[model samples]
Target: MDGRSLWRGAVAAGITLALGIGNASASFLVPQTALPGKNVPKYRDPLPTFAGSRVPATSGYTVSFEEFKQQVLPASGGFGPTTVWGYKINGNGPLWPGYTVEATKGSPATATYVNNLAGPGGTPPLLQKYLTVDQTIHWADPFKLRCMFTPMAAGCFDPYTGPVPAVAHLHGGEDKSDFDGGPEQWFTPNGMRGPAYRTYTSAGAPPAPANGAVYNYPNGQEATTLWFHDHALGTTRLNVYGGLAAFYFLRDDRDTGRADNPIRLPAGDQETEILIQDRQFDTAGQLLFPDGFPSGLNGAPPNPTVHPFWIPEFFGDVIVVNGKSWPYQNVEPRRYRLRLLNGSNARFYNLAFIDGVLRSAPIWQIGTDGGLLDAPVPIVYPGRLLLAPGERADVIVDFTPFAGKTVTLTNNAKAPFPSGMAADPQTTAQIMQFRVGTTVTGDTDGTCDPAASKKSGNKCVLRTTPMVKLATAKGTTAPGVTVATRRQLVLREIEGGGGPLEVLLNNTKWSGIMESTMGTTNTPVAGSTQLVDYWLTELPTLGSTEVWEIINTTGDAHPIHLHLVQFQIMNRQPYQANKYLSDWMAALTAAGKGPGDGPPNPYATVLTDTLSIGGQNQVIGGNLLVTPYLQGSPVPAAPNEQGWKDTVVMMPGEVTRIAVRFSPQGNPIGGSVGYSFDATDGPGYVWHCHILDHEDNEMMRPYIPVKP
Candidate 1:
C-alpha cells in the first residue's frame, strides 16, 4: 500500500451507548393505505401504471386496509406452529424457528408463520390466546404512506388489544423513513405517534437518561423479500412468538426480473417459498415460553425467573412448510427460486435438499438477506435451506436435472449446528416431500450449481466486485491495523444459574453505559439516536494493514458479526475443550476434558459472512487495508465491501480470519492510516451480529474513522 499520509481516519460513534435490554412490548403496525372503493381489491393488471410489466401479479386475495379486523383475520386464524423446520445459514451454528411462505402466480398469496418458542418445561399449546402478553399484528408486503391498525390486546395475549406499541420494517425495502421500520420509529395500539423513541432505557444504567430511543432505516434501497415484526425493548422474542409477524415482498426487479432468472417462476407446484423454522406445541397447539431473562444476559435482574423451557433457542421434532407438516408439494420439471428466512430466537441451520432422502448435494446460493450475488456457489444440498435468527437467503434449485423423480427436502445439519447441540432422536428425523411431475414450469433454464448449500459461508457470490477490478488491486495483501496500532476484542460468557444462553463481545453484557462502565452488558442500539463509544486509531495516509485478533473465552458458539465490510479468513485453531470446561463449568464437567487446538500457523480457509471459533489456539485474526471512501483519498473500494453491505457474522471457535479495507473502495482513511465516513442524521450506519436477538440483547458496537 502506498501514496498517502501516515494516519488518516474518521470516528462515527454513538450507536453503542443507546440500546435497551428490558422486556419488549412491540408488535405489528396499522395499515398505510385504503381499500379499493369496490368490495374486491382494486389492483391493476396493467391498469394505471406498470401496465405491461411482469412483476408478481399483485391481483389476488389482497385484503384492503378497511377490511382488516372484520372480514379477513379472525377468519384466517392468529398464530401457531410452522409447517417445516430447516436451515438458512447451515451447520450447528445459529438457527431459527423455520417454516415456508408461498407466493404463486395466480393463487391467493398467503403465509403461515409459526411460533417456535417453547414454555413451561418445553410443552406447547393446542389452544388460543397463547401467552400472557397482549399483542396483535397487521402487515403489508410493500410500504405505503399510511399505517395499519392493530388491536394488540384483543388478539392472543390478555386485555385483548390496547394501544400496543408497534412498527413495521420491510426487512428488505425501497421505502421512506416513515415506512422503514426502526425500533424507535414506533407507535402504540392506540395510535400514539410515529417512530416515537429510537432506543429504550435499559435497567441498571446510571440514572438520568437524556432522551427516549428511536430507530430509522434506509428504506430507499432496492427491495429483497423482507418481513414485518415486533422490535420493541427486550421482549422481541416473546412478541414474535405471540404470532405478530408476516412476510413481505418488496416491489423490485427481482420479482419482475423472474424472466431472466435461471430458476423459472412458478407455473405450477414445482416452486414454493420454503420458510424453515422450529417451534414447540403446547398440549393445546399454543405457542409457549417461560418468562424472566435467558441465561448469559449481562445485567439481567436477580429475581423474577418465572417460566421454564422456551429457552433462548428452539429446535423442533417435526418439519412443516406452507401449512403442511412434512407435507409434500407437487413439482414440475423445472427450477424454482426459494427465498429462505431463519425466523427463530437462537438457532443455526445447515440446509441441503436431497435427490432421494437426506442425501443429495446442495444446488447453489444466489442471494442473502442483502440480495443476489453475481455468480452462484455450490454446497451440500440439504434439500432444505439454512438460516440464523433474523437471517434470510434467496436460492435457485433446479429440478430439471431430477425431473420426473420423487425427491425429499431433508436436513442433516444437527442442532447446535456447527455440530454441537445434541438432538432428540424423534426430532432429528425431520423431512419434507418433493414429488416431481413430467410437466415443466417454463423453460427450465441454466443453473450455476452442480454443488451448493449453506456451509463454507460465501462462495456462489464473487468475492471481488467491479470496483476491485478498476483500482487494479489484483493480488491481495493481508488486512491489518496501523503498523503501530492494534485492537483486540474478547468474546465472553456471563454465567449465573441455568445453562448460559448467549455470548457477548468484550466481556460486556448487553446492559450498562459505555462512557461510565464500559462493561460488556452495555451495547448501543442500531440506527437513529444511539450515542456510542468508538476508537479510531491513526496511521499513514498511504495506509498500512493492521492485525485484529479476536479472542473468545465463552462456552457456546457465537457468530461474532461486524457490519459494513467482508474479509478473508486468515487462520484459526480450536481452543482446548478441557480448559474450556474447567473455566466454564463445575467440577463434574472437568472430569472429561480434551486437548485444545489452534489453526496451523497462517491457517487459511474459506471466505464467509461468519467464522466459527472454538477454544483451541483461542485466537482469530483479521486485517483491514484502510480503504477510504473519500475521493482523492488513498484507500479505494476495490477490496472493500463494494456491494451494498452493513453486516457480517463471525462464527464461534472457528478463529476465522479476514482482510478488510476501511473504505469500501481503497485502503487507508484519507492519506492517513485511519479515516471515517460522512455522518448524516439518517444514513448513520452501524454494524453487529445479523442475529436479531443478539443485536437486540447488545453484542453490537459502533465505530467511525476521525481526523486527528
Candidate 2:
C-alpha cells in the first residue's frame, strides 16, 4: 500500500504517536508530521475579544459558528492537515483555540450567535461515521432515531446521527436565567431549537437577528476568569472536542492594565494564556475519537442494541496547547503572568516546569477559576500544582535566572485522575517547551512587580473587601443571621448489566419530578423528556443562604459544578465509605429518599462553584469494594484558593460541604447583595459534573432558586 493508505491503517489500529523510524532528529524523539498551526499568519495573536456594546471602540463583533477547514494538526508530525469546526469571525478560518470575548463589570454586552454548520441532520452526524456517537444511550435526538430490529426492545432508540446543534454558555457568569445556556436550550443551524430555548429578552434588549439566538450578558459581578463554550445537551463532548472553547475575561476598574492600578497584575504581551487539551489523530490526518471502549471498561450501553457510541471517559494520545501539539514558545528573561486552563475532555493536569539541566523554575500562583487570590502562594517546583478539568490556575513564572536555556513545562497528573492510569511519556507526560531568551527585560519594567509583591508581607492577606461568609449568612456560626435552609444531597453512579450505564444526581434522571413553584408551567415539551432528563430539585429561596453537603459515593472523582451563583467551599471530611454508602444506597433503593435516611460525614470554610470529588480506591472482586486505601486525610482549599471561586476539586471518600448564597452581597470586592434581575424567572439552571463524557451520559441535574 502507498504511504497515505499505510498511515490510514495505522490510525485505524489506534497507533497513537507518529513513528520517527526513518528520520533522526533525536534518537527516540518522534518527529513532526506537519507544519505547526502557529506558522500560519494571524494564528497567534491574543484572540480578538468581542465586547458587544455600543461603545464604538469596544463594542463586540458578532460571530457565527461554522464548519470550515483549518490545519489543526501539524503535517510534520507524521500527520497531514485536519478539517475541524470552530467559531469564525469575519468569515475567517475557524481558529482552533476558538475566540475570546471581554466584558466589563456593570457594562452589559449583547451578541447574536449564528450556527452555520453543514449537514448530517437528515441522517446520522458525519462524525458518527468517522468517530463514535452511541445512539443507544440517552442523547440529543433531533431526528428521532430508532433501532432497526424486528422486535424492538423496550427503552431502545435507534441512533440518530444528523446535523449538529449549537449553543454558547458562559461558564462562570451571573446572568439572567434565560441567557444561562442550559443544555435543553440547544438550537440547530436550521433554527430547530431545544424545548427550553429562549431568546435574549432581558427587559429592553433589541430583537434577536434572524435565524440565531441573541445572548445579553450582564457583567454585573466581580472581575474574574470565565470561559465560553458549546453547552448543547448530549453533544457537548463532540462539539467541544471539535474545538469551540475560549476564554472570557470580566474586567473592572481595579484590574485595569494601567501602571497605577491598585491590584497590578500582568497586562499587554506579558500576560499570556495557555489552553491545555488532549486529542487523538487518525492516520488519514483527521481528528480520531472512538464511540465506545471494546473491553467495556466503560459499562455496556443501558440498551446495547440502540446506543452504541457512548463511553465512560475519553483520553487522547496527543497534548495540544494554543492549537499546536508539542509546540514551543520564545520567552524573554523576566517574570511573566501565565493563566493555565485545563480544557481537556476528561484528563487532569499536574503541571510544573523543568529546564534542560533538569532544574525547575520558581512558580507562584496568583489566581484560580474564579479570579485572583488575595496573596501569592509559592508553588515549589516538582510539587506541581494539580488542575482538574474546568479548573484554572493564575500563576507567575520568573524566568530571569534561566535565560539562554530551554525549559519544558511538564505534566505528571494521572489520567482518569487520582487513581487512573499514569501518563504515557510519548503523549501526556510532556506538555510544551519554552526557550528563554538571553536578553533580559528590565527588572521592574512589567506592570506587575513580582519582586515587590513577593516581599509585600501580606502575601497571605486578602485585599478584596470582606463579603458575608457562608457561615455568617447561614447563621450556623457567630456574627450572622440564621440560615435560610440546609440540604444534604448525594451524587451516585448507576451500573447496568455489570457494565457502566449512566451517572445520576440523587439516583434520579433529568425527567424525574421536581417540585416546581411555577406549577405545571415548568413542564418540558412533549416527547423531549425521554431517557435523558433532569429534575429541578434543590430550589433555594432567592435571597437566602443554604449549606449543601455533597456526598460522593462513586470510585471516580467528579468535578461538581453549579450554574448561576458562585459558592464557597466549606470543608471536606473523611467518612466510612462502605458503611455510609451501604445505608445511603438502601435508602435510595427503598424510599427514593436521600440523606434524610442516611448520609455521609459533614465538614465545613471557603467558597467555590466547582469542587473535585476525591475518587475512592477499589479492588477487583465479586463486587467493587471501596477500601480506604487511597483515602488519606481530608484536603482543604489552598491558601491561594480561599478566595471567591467558581470551581474547586472534591475528593472521593469525603463529603464536600459548600455554602451557597442566592442573592449578591455587597462586600469589599465590588457588588451588592442581590441580582440585577429576576433570577427565578425563565428556563432555570442546572448543576453537573464538568467532565464532558460523564456530563453527556448522565451526572447532571437541574435546580431552581425559588422566590421567597
Candidate 3:
C-alpha cells in the first residue's frame, strides 16, 4: 500500500486498540466562571527591576529561568496554583512575564542568562507536565538529532522528555549576531549546547556560570519598545507559552521615559506597560495545550504518520493581560501612556476602548515596533489598532473626558488574522476593563493632545524632533538613498489529506541543499558535516539598502519580521495568486527535479510516489519577479504603519513591499556605513513570520550580511 493508505490504517488501528491511552480528559473550551474578566488585579510592577550588578561593574545584569507557582484563577473558583517557568531578576522573583530590563541608549549593557530550568538537583520541574515537545519538527534535539534523518524513526516520532533547552532572543534589538539569540543558540540545563552557541564576556565582565551564556548589547539603536523571549528551535511556542518572556525598554535623551525628559511624555505613575495574550487552562487551573491525539480534545493530526502531535495553529478562548486572566486596572482621569505588546502565540488583536456601545476615547499611536513615528496617528472612535504577535505599539490615551465611567478594552480581530473565525463577544472579544476613578486627580494633559482643537495649523504637534522619513507614499526612494537590489520572496503552504501539513518560505527547508533559479546549488553552511546548519539565503551587503517584495499566496495574512534592522513599508498591491503559483510550479517541473524534492524531502518523496504531484522550486539567487502578475495600483501604507517597523502585516494575494537598510535607524540613508558593532560575524540573523506556530515550522529563513 502507499504511504497515505499506511498512515490511515495505522491511525485507525491505534484509535481502536489504545482508545483510552491518550489525553481523554482534555477540555476544548474553558468555563466562563473559571476565568471571569476583571476579577484579578493587573500585574504592573516588575518588582525590583534588574539593576546592573555593581560588584562586577562590567556584569550588566543576570537573570535565570526557574519554576514557580502563581494563582492564575481565583481561590473562590476552587482552582489550585498553576506552575510556571519564569525568569528571576537577581534572585528576587521567578515572576511570570519577568521584570523589565531598563537600558540607556548610548550605554552598553551585558546580560548573563542561566538555564536553570532543571531546578536544584537537575530534576525536571513541575512545569514539564504542561510541555509537549514535538520531536517531528527540526528543533533543539539535544539527544541524538534523529529527526534530521527521517521522521519515521522511533526517536523522531515520540515526544522529547529530556532536559529542556532554552535560548533568549531580544526581539527587535539590533545587536551583534552572537547576541542576537538565533534559533540554533540553545543551551540546556545539563550543560548541553547547540552547534551555533557562543558566549561573549566583554573586557572585565563576569564569567558566565556553567550551562549559561553571556550576551553584550551596545544599545546603539533608537529608543523603542523591545522585548525578550525564549527562541529555541522548534520549542519556541511551548517555551514562550510557559511564561518565559519579559520587556526590555531602551531609553534615550529624547524619550527618557521620565516626565522631565525632553519629549515631555507621560512617565512614572502615568505610564504603564501592558502585555496581552490568550491562553487556556484545565479545570484544575493547569495549562492545557493540544497534543493532536486522535482521542484528545483536539482531534487527530492532519498528517498522523508524518507528525503524531503537531497542529497548524493554536487559539485560546480566554484573554490574558500582564499575566492575569482578564484583569483590570483603576486609572485617574488624565492622559496615560500605555505601551502595548501582543505576546500571544498566534492570536492577533484589534484593540479599542469601548464604553458600552461607543468607543470611549481616542488612542494616539506615537510609536511602532522600532521607535517613535514622525507624528501621532489618531485612532478615533470606530477605529482599532491591530497588533500581531511580537509587535509593539506606544500610544497615549486621554481618559480626562471619561471620568467616573467604566471602559472596556475590547478586541475584534479574527483568529488566524484576516479570513478566520470572528472573536466571540463574551470571551476573546473583551480583553479587560478600565475602572476610571470618579475623582479628578492632580494630572495635566500634555502638550501633545489628541483633541482636534489642540492642533497647531493642520497637524497635531506630537513631537519637537521630526523623525527621518524613509519613503514617500508614491513608492519612490527618499532623496538621499537608492535601492541596491530588489528581492522577491514567496510564502506557501503544503497541504495533506486532513489539513495543512506545513508551511515554507520560498519552498525551502531549514537545512540541506537547495537549487537556486540560476541552476546552482547553495548550502547554508560551507563544508559542514552536521545534520543542520544555517540555511542562508538573501545575502545582502552590509550597509546597503534593499527592497524586499514579499508575495503571499497563502489564504491568510502573515506578520513578517526581520532581526537586525527596522524597515519602512513602501506599499502593497493585489496580484493574481493562482497564476503566480502555477508559474512557480511549472518552473520547478522544468528543472528536472521531482515534486517531493524540497526540504523535508522524505515527506515529499512519499507524496510524489502516492499522489503524483510536485512542489514549488527552492529558488534563490535571482528574484521570482511579480511584475507579470500585478493587478491593480499599489496601496500606500496605513498612517499608523508609516513609521520605522521591525514587523509588518503582509495580506493574502498581495505583494507587500518594504525598504530595509541593514543599519541603525538614526544613521544616514545610504553609503557603506553599518552598525556600531560588526555587521558580518557569528551566526547571522533571520527573517520569519511572527506567528509562532508558523515560525516553528519551516516558515523561517536565515540570511547573512557580507561586508562590502
Candidate 4:
C-alpha cells in the first residue's frame, strides 16, 4: 500500500503503536512490525553539521519551510525516503534541524521567515496525510472552524488538511514581544493570519511580505545557545515534530566561538551540536504519529469523550539525532564541546557515556539555557546530565582517556519524567556512538581543563575573567537586591472520567473571560476571599525583580520555561499536595466558582464560564500559601543549575522557587533597567510547560512588562 493508504488504514482501524503503550493488534494495524532500532546499523551514517554567518548581517538570512524527502531510516533497513517539512536556509536544500545562525553581542541581526508548506497551486502538503490535527484544542484555527467552541462539534475530530500556519520563536531570546513569535502571532502561506500576527521591520529595512515575518534580534544579552522553532497555537507539537527547528548562538568577547579566544574552549571542528529526539516510522518508512487510536501500543485517548484525537503525551520508540537514526560521529582523542539540546516533545533524558561496563568520561558542564556558568560542573558516574524537553546543556568531554575505544551515549530517564516507564533497552536507551580515534591531534588542554580548576573564595578558578553571579548561593537572592513582589502560582490538571481533559497553569485557559478580567476593574465577592476583579497577575514592572513560587499539584514533573529573560533557580521544597488542593477547592467553592458556573460568553473558547480561580493576589483566597504546608526545608539547586536559566524542572509535590528580573541577564541587581528594545509593546510573552503536549493545551500563561 502507498503512504496515504497506510495512513488512512491506520486511522480507520484506530491502531496504536509502542513506546510504553500496549502492543498493537496484528490483525488490524497496517504495519504488523516496525523496523526494529537494532536492525539499523549503528554508526553507519556520519553526523551532519551546518553553520550560519559568524559576522552580523541584517537581511541576507532567509529561512523557509518546504516539503522534501530525507533518509530518516538508513537504506540498508529496506526503507525509502521519508517525506518531511524542514527549513531551507538561503535558498539551499531543506534540512532537518536547520543550520546554526551565529551573532555577536550588542549588535543586531535580522532574518525573514517564509511559510511555504502549501503544495502546487496552494494545495495541502503531502506531510499532512500523516498528521491528525486535534481541532478540539485551542489553535490557530486558520479556517475559523471554531471546533473548540462546542464539544464533539462537526469537523472537530477530523484532521486539518489545509494550509499550515507557522511562526518562528527564538527560544531564550531577549527580544521585543513582536519578535517573540507567540502562539497567537502565527501566519499561513494562504494569506490567513492569527489574531496577534504582526511582523517587525528594523530601521532602514523593508516591510515583511504577507506570507512572511521579518524580525530583528537586539543581541544585548550574554552569549548563550538559543534555538528557533515553530510556535503556532495548538499544533506546535505537530509542526516541530515535522522538522522545523534550528540553532541561534549569541556570542560575546569573553566566550567567543574561537580557539584563540581568552576562554580557550573547544572551537571550530572540535565543537558540535547534538539535538536528540524520538520518532516512530511506518512500514513505508514514513513518519507515524498517534491519532487517539483505540488499538495497539498507542491505546485510546485518555479522555476520548472530550478530545477525540488529543493524547496526554507521546513517546517514540526510536531515537534520532541530527536527522539520522542511530548515527555516530568519529572523533579524535581530544577534548570537544558538545552543545546538547533535548528537542523531544515529552521525553526527558538522563544522558551519560559508557565504555563497556564502566562509565566512560566525566562531563564538564559550562553553560545552560541562558549562558555560561560561573564555573564548570563536573558530572561523574551515577550522576547523569538530566535535560528535560526544551532544555539545553553546554558541556565538554575529553576523549583522550579512551583512545581507540567505542563510547556509547545512553539515556536512563523514564518517560513522563520523574515516575514513568523506563526506556526500551534496545531502542530509546541507546542514543548514539562515538568511535574515538587512537591518534590525538591538537590535544591542548587550555584553561577550560577541569583538572586545572579548584575552589577559591566560594567560586571555582577556571576562568581568568569572572562571570556575573546571579545569586550569592543557591536559593539565596542576589546581594543587595530588594524584591518588589512575591507570588504563588499553581500547576494543575483538570481530569475527566478517562484521564486528563486539560492541564492548566494557574487554573486558567488560554483565552476567554478569565484572561479578559485581568488588569481591569476590581470588586470583592460576598463572603469569599475571591474578588470580582484583580490587577494583572504576571505583568511585572520592566526591570523589576520578583520571586515566583511554583506549586505543582500534579503527579508528574514539568519543565517550566519563561521567555525573554533568564532567571536563577532559587530552591525547591516538598509540600502536602492533597491538603493544598483540598483547601484550594474549598476557596473556589466559597467564591461561587465551580466547574461550569456562570453564564456562557460567545467570545470565550474554553473559559466561557466563571470557573477560573482568577489571576493575581493568589494568597488572598484562604491564605493559600505554600509555606504552611511545607514538608521540609528547601533544597538548593543542583550543581549544574547554579547559573542563569530560562527553563527549569519543577518536580511533583514540590514548590519550585525562582528569582526573575524583568530585564537582561547582564543588568545589575537592585536597579530598574529594561531592554534596549520595547518589551512592553506587542502581544507580550508566555511561560509554559515545555512539553509540547501540555503546552498545546492550557498549560501556558502570558505576561507583559510595563514601565515602572
Candidate 5:
C-alpha cells in the first residue's frame, strides 16, 4: 500500500516506439513564419456574439453540432478554408466560436442539442474519431469494462472504435445531475449510446429526442461567465480541441439591475467577451492534434510501445482569438471592458499589452471567474495578468492613451506553467494586435456617476468608485464563525511501466466502490488491498461548512476543480513534505491503504472550486524522494484573487487550505436558504483538473453529496 511501491519498477526501458493498431504521431507542423501574420486578409470582419435566440427561462432553443468553414488564416498563408465543428442556431452557418446563451437567475432555460456531424470519408466511412483518444487509459467503452491488476483491481473501458460520441457540460453551472452533462452520458450520431445516457426531462415528461438531449439549465446561482464544452469520456480533449465550446452568462439583479443594482458595469457593445484558444493546422487546412500513440517523449522516444501517441500536455503554436489565427481588432480610443476566457487545452497566459517595448498601458482587473470584485485592481505597466487554462479575468483596458499607435497583446507564460520551459518568442509570445482608430467614440452613457469613472470627467463607465465586492474571505475562518468539519486530501501521479500511466485523486480512480466505507463492509474485494479504483470518499453534509486541505505531492502544478459549488481560499502554508509524506505513507501501509488514506485537515476559509496546487522542485531518485527544493516561505493569495473564486492556483510543495460550504445559508456574506433543487441525487457530480488533457486521462474523480 506504500505510494512508492504502487509505481516502483513500473517503468520498463527498451520498449519499441513502433506503431500499434491504433498508434499515431504528428506528421506536420506549421511554418515558423505563419506565426504573427498580423497583416493577413481582414476577412471574418465583425466578430459574432450569440445573445441567445430566445430569452433564457422563457422558451427552449435548439443548437446543432455541425461542421463549417472559416477563413482562419489569410489566403496568402495557403491555409485555406478549414472544416471546423461549431454550434448553430436556426440552421445558420459559420457559427465559429459558438453563440453565447444568456439566461437570468432563478429561471430555467432549455435547449435541444443535436449531433449532425458526418464521419470522415473513406472506403466505408472511417467514422470520424478522436485521434488522441488513448485506448490504454480508462475511457467510456460501449462494450465491457477492462480491469487491470496491481495491488487492487482497477477498471477501464475499451477504446471507442466507432463514430464520434458527444455531450455538453455546462461548466460552473449548478444544474441537476441529469442535466450536468456527465462524461458517461454520451451518444453517437448513429444512435449508439454509452451506459449512463439519460434524457434531459422532468419526471413523467416525454423522453428527450433520439441522439440528442434537452438540457435544463437551472440558473439558480450567482451570475457568472460559464461555458459549454464536450464531456464525452475519453475524447474530451479531442472534442473541445475540435471547436465545440461556447459561453453562457447568467444575469441577476445584482449584476445588471436598474436602481437595485449597486454595481453599474459596462453593457452591450462596450463589453466584449472573447474566447482565447491555441491550435495547430495541417498544411491541408485540417485541424491537427498529437497522435494518441506518439513515437517519442520530449524528443526522445521513451517507451513508445506504452502510449504511442499520448503526451502529457498539448501546446499549440498558433494563438487563436475567437477562432481566428492572430486576428486583429479595430478599437476606438476609449474605455472598453474585456471579458477574457482561457479556452485553451493546456497553455497559460501572462497577458500584457505591449506597444513597442515591454509594456505601455495598464490593465484594470475588475472581476474574476465568479464575477465582480470588491474594487478595481490596477495592473500597472509591465504587469502581467496570469491566467491558467479554464481561468477567466474581467478587465478594462483604456485605448485613449495609444490612439494612433498599434499595440499588441502578448503572452509570456511558460509551457506546462510555472516550472516548465519558457514559451517560444515567435509563436506563443504574441497573441493579437489592437489597432486603435483615430475616431473618438466618446462615452454616451451620459452619467458622471463615480461608480463608473476613474475621475470626474474621464468618462469610464466601469472604473467606478466603491467597486462592488461580492464575496471575500481569507484566513483560517470567516470572522466570528466556526467550521463544522475538516478533511485532508492529496494529489498524486502514478507512473507506469512506460511512463506516467495515470494520475489519481485521493489515490483512487473512477470505480463503483464507495470510499466513505473504505475500511468497512463496502471496501474492495479481498487480495485487492490497494486503492486504485474510484470510490465515493467525500460525502459532504448539506447545509454545513468544512475545510479541505489539498496536499500536492507531484512535481506539476495541478488545477484542482470541484463541481456544484464554489469555494473561497484561505491562506497557503509550507510544510515538511518529505517528513509528512513518510509518516503518511507509513500510516497508509499499516491500514492496508494507499498513501491517500488519511491526514489531518487544516482549517482555513478560502472559497474556490478550482485551485492550482503549486509544485515543489523535488527530485525523484531510486527508492528515495528528496524535497530540498521546498521554498522557505509560504505563498499568499494574489490581491486580485481575494474575491470569490471557483478556482485557485496551488503552488508546488504548498498546502492549500480552503473553506467550503455546502449550502448558501451558511455563507459568510448575507446567507440564503440553500440550493433550489436536491443536492444529493442521481449519478452525482465530479471534480477534477480543468486541463482538458488531464481530465481525459486518469486525473479526474467523482463525488456525491449526502444529507447530514
Candidate 6:
C-alpha cells in the first residue's frame, strides 16, 4: 500500500479536531452477544472461564455484567498499536454470580452489566454498576458503553466531564429493538438515581452515564456469534477505545439442516470459532493516535487535550483471538469448521489460510450472526470478506493436510486503513495465528465414537436457532407483498457551524428519552415506545418486492445494513471521500474541500450486504432486493437476522434501497404469525446501522409490529 492510499484509506476517527473541536461538545454519539460444545465429556463451564484467561490476573473483581465500570486514567499512553479497555471485565471470586462464561445450545442468556465511569475531570471511586436495562427513557437497549472511562491522547484527562453516560448494544443479533441494544436505553451510573434516564418525553435532564444496570441482552436469537460495545450519546469513539468490547456465542442445539445429510467433511473438532481484532498502543504501551488529531475529523475543533487515543473504528495492529493478542491455537490435522469475525473497530481484513490453497475454497461459510447459511458455498479465491466495525463472519477451514505442519492464516489488508487510518509495519504487517497440530487423535478428547454427526461435509449441524433468532421469531411478512409503506432513512452528518460530530442515522440527537416522535415518520407504537417498520406493505406475502431508499446526508462513506435477511447489492454512485490529511496543509490541498464544499471521490457500491460505503461526498447510491428463502411470516419476521443482528450499515452518501421480509423462518407466513408471541417483555425487533456510534446518536429508531 502506498503512503498516499494508506493515508486515504486509514485516517484517525475520534480526534477532538483543531479548527472547530476546541469548544465543540463531543457529547454522546454512539451505538453499541454465547456458546456450547459437545464432546462425550459433557464439559461443564465454571465462572472463571467467563472472566477470560487473564481475568484472574487483571482488575481482580469477578463482577457480573452489572458490576463493571469504565476506567479513567490520570495519564495517557503515547502512540503505538491501539490499546483496549474491556467493557465488563471482572475480578476473581470463589464462585461469583453470573461471572462465568457459559455456552450452550437451545438455552436463553441474559446480562445486567453497568457502568460507573466518572465524567471528564472525575476522581477515583467513580464506578457505579447495578443498573438494569428495564428502566430507561423510551429506550430499547438498556446497556451502556462507558466513554468517559476511555483513555485519551498521551497524558490527557478531562476530569471535568459532562457525563460518562452510556448505552450499549450488540451490533448484530436477531433480537428486537429492546434486546437489540439501542441508544434510547442510555442511562447514567445511577438508574432512576441519575438525571433524565427514563424513557419519557417530558423528562428534562442533565447528562449522566448509565451504570451496569442499564444494559442487558436476552440472547434468544440463533446460535451465531455476536459482540457488545458502548453506545453513549456522543462519545462512542472514545468509549469503545477505552476498552469496552467482547464476543458472545449463542449455541444452537437443534439442526437447521445445512450440513450434508449424506456427505462428509474431510474432519476434526466438529466446529470452531475464530476471533480477530486489532489494537494500537502508545510508546508507553498505550494506544496510538494518528497524526493531526485533537480535532477528530478535518477542519474540526480540536479537543482540549492532545493525546492520540484510537477512534471509533478500531482495527488494531495485532490480531486478537479469544482475548489474547496474536495468540496461536494448536489444531489437530482434520477439517475444522471455523467461524470468523472481524472485530476491528475500523480496520477491514481480507483473510486467507496459507495452507495448500483451497480446492473449491472448501465450504467456508456456514452461519452468520443470525444463523447458518442455507448451504455452504465453495470459496473460489480470497477476495474481500469485508468486516465493518462491530461486524462478524462465522466461517470454517479444513486443516486436514496441514495437521503436523504450521500454516499461517494471514491478512494482506493494508493498514492506516483504506478509508480510516494508515497502517505501519509494526501495526499493519503483523500476522494472526492459526497453528496446525503436531499430533492428532481420532475421536479426540479421549472418547471413541461420541455421537458422530449424522451429516457429511459439515462438522456440526445447527440443531437450533440462536437466541437472537428467538428474539425475532414471531411473524412473517406476507409474500408477494408490494409497497404498503415507504419511509426514507437518511444517514447525515454536519460540520463547520457545529452539528453532530460522528455518525447519525437520520437527523436526530441521541434521545436520552422519548420525543415528539422517536424513530422516523412511519414508525408504530409498541408497549410504550416507537419502532421502525421496514416492511413494504403494498407487496405480496411470498414474492413481494418494493423500492426502499437510504439517503446518505453525511460527508463520509458509511456501510448501511438491513437486518432480518441478506439482499443483492444493486449499484452505487460515487462522491468525495473525507480528506483529513490533505486538509491539514497550511494551504488547501488539491483534494481538500474548503470547509463546507462537499468531499471528493465518492463512488456507489453495488453490494451483497457486506461492502463498505465510502463516507461523505455530495451523494452516493446502493440498493438490494429482499428474497426470502422460506415463505410467510408474522410479527415482522426477518429470520435471516435471527442467527443474530439488530442493525446494519448504510454507507455515507448512499441511499441503500432494499425489500425486507417481516417473517419467514420456520413455517409459512400465515403459519408463523402470532403463533409464539411474547408480549410480556417482547421480541420487539428492529434494524439499523452497524456503525453503532451513528445509531446511538439518534441515528437509530425502532421496528414494531401491528398484528392482524
Q: Give candidate 4's whole-model lDDT.
A: 0.74
> Candidate 1's error at 308, in angstroms?
8.4
User: What does candidate 2's lDDT look like per residue over 26-141, in tens digits?
Assistant: 10112223222333322122222222311111354455776656555555544555666676654444676665556677787776677766655444334434444544444555
Candidate ranking under lDDT, highest first, comes to: 4, 3, 2, 5, 6, 1
**Alpha carbon deviation, residue 594, candidate 5 (Å):** 5.7
Query: Which residue runs of candidate 2 sit more than 4 Å off their true CA positions?
Result: 1-60, 90-93, 119-128, 144-159, 202-206, 258-262, 293-306, 441-444, 450-468, 471-482, 513-534, 592-635, 665-672
- What candidate 3 gets wrong by more than 4 Å, as runs, is 1-59, 294-299, 452-464, 512-532, 593-623
The candidate scoring highest on TM-score is 4
On a 0 to 100 scale, what is the lDDT of residue 698 in model 2?
Answer: 59
Worst 10 residues of 3 by lDDT: 606-615
TM-score of each: 0.54, 0.79, 0.87, 0.88, 0.80, 0.57
Summarize candidate 3's per-residue lDDT along 59-107 as a digit string, tens digits: 3888798778876655555557888888886664677778777778888
Query: What do the candidate models score in CA lDDT, each in turn?
Result: 0.34, 0.61, 0.72, 0.74, 0.60, 0.37
Candidate 4 local lDDT, 124-167, one digit each (tens):
88777566677778888888876555533456666677889999
Error of 2 at 303 (Å): 7.6
> How close to the true structure is residue 585 of candidate 3, measured as C-alpha lDDT?
72
Please rank every candidate by TM-score, starting with the best.
4, 3, 5, 2, 6, 1
